[model samples]
Target chain A: MLVSTARLHSVLKTAVDGIIVIDDSGTVLVFNDACVHLFGYERDEVIGKNVSILMSEDDAKSHDAHIKRYLDTGEKRIIGQGREVSGCHKDGSPIPIELSVGEADTSEGHQFIGIIRDLRARKAFEQRVRDLQSNLVVMTRVNALDEMGAAIAHEINQPLTAVMLYLQTAARRMKTLEEQDPQLLSIMTRAVDEADRASKIIQRMRSFVEKQEPQKVGVNLASLIDECVELVMLGHKNDNINVISNFSDHDYNLTVDAIQVQQILVNLIRNACEAIKDCKKQEVYVDVDIAATDVFIKVTDTGPGLCEEVREQLFKAFTGTKRRGLGVGLAISRSIAQNHGGDLFVEPYVKGKGATFVLRLPLGLDGADGQSNLASASMI
Target chain B: MIHVIEDDFSVRDALQHLFTELGASSCTYSDAESFLNFLKQVTAKDCVLVDLHLPGISGVEVIKYLRELSDPPHIVAITGKSLAEINKAFTGIKRPPIVRKPLKEECLLREMDLGTALNSA
Candidate 1:
């Protein structure tokens, strides 16, 4: 029985954990293999040394008092139930550990045994995950703020210029005429110039926020729709939900903001997926048809049609029906379409069917202005 | 005569001084309620320069209130918030004029049909 007991003790010593035993006088008695691995000290080096030697500065200060009290008063504090404690490694890294200690009373007096579970790796991983999540959220909010800054730049730029021209005209008139003809010909002109700068900044911001690789070269509506659907599926689609796309052959291209267009498609697809979450079919259908004058891409979800309330402010910013999101997706999408001399609309799907979002852009990509589509093709 | 409705202190402060300097007779209100109260009593041949976004009430409602006036002056929706809001303001009132800000003196002069200051309101 004594030999078997010795064999079992040796087996326990090699197990993956820090196991330690101390005599009633607090002299070291047992130190296991795992303890050596954790502290980077051999048994011969640590077995006779004081336990406090293995603790961090803060841990050692309190541990000194704890052991002194137990020895003096025969009172137990943390020597029974396991408590989370910090351990200091040889390399000076702090390791989190759960320690359980108990006393073995014999004719001589009592000894204490401790079991410590290391949690350094797990805590490190959790911290890394939290840091990444925090960074992602911060970036997304900044992107939204930046996007609005751009939108305002476009709208305010023109009137600002006209205002400036009026200023210069008034300045000349003021010198030539008697009365103050809005002393702002120069001021208005400056405001317009500044507004133009603001618009450029806005465009730059949009480009910065969505810096994903541009799908340049003549991209057809069919291919764009497919790409969008694929992206949505990666995030939201699953075994229960499927998406079907029907695209028409389009031979033309638009001098379009392809990144902006993809953004719209993603929003629409996401909106559709969210809409049909609990429906039976749980499928979203995207149908693309290219006309001689326009290109139409419609997204239909099997979910119930939009309620009366959602229909009212369908394309308004901040005021949207989505439960999760900036509610600016559709609003931004609509604006991009409008900017491209195109339009995105919400048409009644089938009377009792789902919602249909249609995107229609003018034929020939360069129609938004006299600007060449060649510029767009390069960016694409 | 014009009713200046705005909320952003910095922008509104500049507008108050700008309109006063430009020689347009005006009253300034920081909130929709204060402006509505003043507009109710100030019955005259005056235009309204209102921000589209305001605290307590929307600029759209302000437009509706002006439309109900017995002799409504031209309501010019002035804002620096968003183009969508400007578009909505125009569409809401069937093409009402709008001026967006930094409050340029010439834009204000031209939009308000202000002739030479010698013919002050």
Candidate 2:
């Protein structure tokens, strides 16, 4: 069954996407109703005008050249592909559009049919999702900090109490001493050491809890892992879990939001420690390998390996197996990984062995999609 | 005698130093498990200064166990935990005199002496 020209015209007019056909010289030949609605222009007004009128100034300037280049060289730059481009609306505002161009050699001349889809609604929806995700990440951090604050206070107070006692004893001994005694000096030295210990705990806590916008910077992977391990081990001191880390021989510098990456590492390492708590062989192995374009951090535990059932919903939010947490750590960690153009996942479970969680991150922030980076940057 | 039950080695050693400086006999235990094992030697005349956040058997459990004894030792609760947490842990049980961490020597001695006096009464 052959469709008439009138049927094809009607089909183009009723199409959801805007359809516009332009000649090789860049003059708009046919503009359908969808195109009229898309650019706020009538078909009659656009049909005889150059298609450059619907493009931004920069794209408009290169519009004719691009078509001429393809025609002259028979090179298919965008003619056979789709890309996101900026289009100028009738009101002179920029609009994000998905453009796909198809070439046709007709009886009259060369024609390029461009299928354009308005991306305003989609971009707005994406922005909302990103905002919600950012908020959830902050909330997760605050919740974790709240629980950690208690433990930190307990940790810091132990040393603080020791410092106070040591000093008090020294003061009493000094009151009775005829001269400066070596024993009192040793007591004073111990007090100073305890004070330094408490200060270091506060410093680590401050770095973890300080609220800051996400900004990518160069970070040493080995140092970051060591810091996270130390922080996680503070709470698990009595658990007797041994954490061993190995770094591949390479430049360990990578661009990342350090605190955010540390958050993921802390969650992973802590989870590993918790996993091996009940096991006879309690060990957590952290390995960092830098590949050609990406870095991989793997955390392995000697606990009971994950079951098929537990591994299924592992990254889903609010499904934590632990008794205390809201179970959003893995979910938030995965979200952070994806936001960085990376991923977090568990390896295949082996019976009677242990589980390994892998975090893969790009060496550069260029891998992240531009829109999210722009949104995060503007949010600050 | 003042018995110090603390998990941290520094705090345990400092408490021993304080007891020696004050000329009071005292013994220190690293955790609740070890302290409980030595409970057979404790008496009503002795005062126990126990940290609530211990590994293994917890200080609250130790206190409860001591309270169940016919001649329970005088107990002083020493902790870095907040009052609310301490209260929650001691729910429905008689709580001992609570001492906060970064402990003041005077306050701690006062509590220990008060506990011993009450026990011997």
Best candidate, TM-score: 2
List the TM values for chain B, per candidate.
0.80, 0.89
Off by over 4 Å in 1: A71-76, A153-316, A320-380, B1-121
> How well is each residue in B4-117 modelled by candidate 1, as lDDT tens digits?
787765555555555555556667788899888776664436767787768679888888888888867667777654455456345635756776654555556667644422
| Cand. 2 Cα-lDDT | 0.78
Chain B alone, candidate 2, TM-score of: 0.89
- Model 2, A231-349: lDDT tens digits are 67767778789998886333346678776787788889989998888899999999976677778899999999898889878987667778997787887687667656678999998
Candidate 1 chain A has its poorest 10 consecutive residues by lDDT at: A371-380
Candidate 2 lDDT over B1-121, as tens digits, reads: 7788998899899988977776677889999888888888888888899999897898999999888888987889898755445665787888899887767677787788744544443
For residues A1-380, write the lDDT of model 1, one tens digit per residue.
89997996886677787888777555677888889888887888777667876778887777767877888897877866888888888788777988899878866667788887888887875575455345434644554565555555544544543444444444444555555546455665565567556545654654553453223334555555666676667676345778888764343345455556777777788888878878888888888666767778788888888766677688776776557776776777786676555789888535678898998866664454222334333222
Judged by DockQ cut-offs, is candidate 2 incorrect, acceptable, medium or high? medium
Per-candidate clashes come to 15, 0
